[model samples]
Target: MSEQSNPIRSAIAEAIADNPTILFMKGTPEQPACGFSARTVAALQALGAPFAAVDILPDPRIRQELSEISNWPTIPQLFVKGELVGGCDIITEMYESGELAEVLGVEEATKASDPNVAPEGQPVQAAPLGIENRLR
Candidate 1:
């Protein structure tokens, strides 16, 4: 089936469109399944950037559809404003350079001093089949 006609691809696209900031990763932000995903989550959390997370491990198809749509064959994919921002390495670089804060619209003063300190509160999680919830 064509990507446009694929339901999973359609849902993935919709999720990207719906959430200003979203991460399609191996596991939930609170419990990342891989180091790459964990680092990505930490970067966003340190910046106190509110984002929607979709755990792609529950279904292999989720990762497949997401990678197909993103054209980024990486587990931790970060999308901002419905555009692919990149994966862990890129995110880490951006975070270090303060570019991630700019991308996420995090104020200079709000950027956490310690990258290890995750912001308080639960990150929004997108449902596997029907992703719902915007960055709050």
Candidate 2:
């Protein structure tokens, strides 16, 4: 079917295009329904990054459509500035290295929400590398 006829695809497109940071996850960040999602949420929360999250579990088509669009067959798919930034493990590593904060343009904290702020730094310019997290 054409994307015009598929509301799910259209919605996914609009959401990705509209939001600077969005996560197509299995559940809300506040209550992630899966372990990977929970970890992903925690990483974003640690960075204090505000993101729009879409729960793909509510509709099977949402996951399918998102996968088709992103060409990444996984939930908890993170998009930063309209670009895919990989899934749980990548996010965790980036969070640890403070790359996520740079990507989100937030002040990189030595620790999450620590009072002692570090000097302003530039974001690491890196291409999105896909790390498949097919484990359920």
Candidate 3:
């Protein structure tokens, strides 16, 4: 059957179009339910960029539909400007290389560089977001 007939596909498409920067992750940005998701969230947070996130945990169909539509067999999928940027590894690499900030149209902030804070730097840490395996 064509994907157009699937409501989940439509929802995923709508979400990507609606949000300039969105993540189809395992959980919310405040509490990602996976190590990959947490890392991805942290990378984005470090960039100080805003993003919308959808948790695929409530329904297995969401992840299935997302994979079918994105043609990417992974959660923590990132979309920027309605384009799939990839998952955790890609996001981390992009963050380290400053490509993520460029994609998000934000200035890259240096670690421990906030002038308002003391000389001792406070690292931007990903919240203690738990990790859940969906591949099983």
Best by TM-score: 1
Superposed by TM-score, candidate 2 places the C-alpha of residue 6 at a distance from the truth, in angstroms, of 1.1
Error of 3 at 33 (Å): 0.7
Candidate 3 residue lDDT tens string, 5-61: 665666777778877888888877766688888888777766667677788897788
**Highest-lDDT candidate:** 1
In candidate 1, which residue ranges exceed 4 Å CA deviation? 2-5, 117-119, 122-136
Give the residue spans of candidate 3 off by over 4 A. Answer: 1-5, 110-136
TM-score of each predicted structure versus truth: 0.85, 0.79, 0.78
Question: Comparing candidate 2 with candidate 3, which one achieves the higher lDDT?
Answer: 3
**Candidate order (lDDT):** 1, 3, 2
Q: Give the TM-score of candidate 3.
A: 0.78
Question: Per-residue CA lDDT of candidate 2, range 1-136, in tens?
Answer: 7866776677777778877888878766656788888778777766666677777886687788888898998778999878999898888788878888898898885345431221133132221121111211
Please list the C-alpha lDDT of all candidates, in the order they appear: 0.80, 0.70, 0.72
Residue runs of model 2 more than 4 Å from their true location after superposition: 113-136
Model 1 per-residue lDDT tens digits across residues 1-136: 7755676777788889888899898878888898899888888887778888888876777788888888999889999999999899999899999899899888856776565555667455544345422211
The TM-score of predicted model 2 comes to 0.79
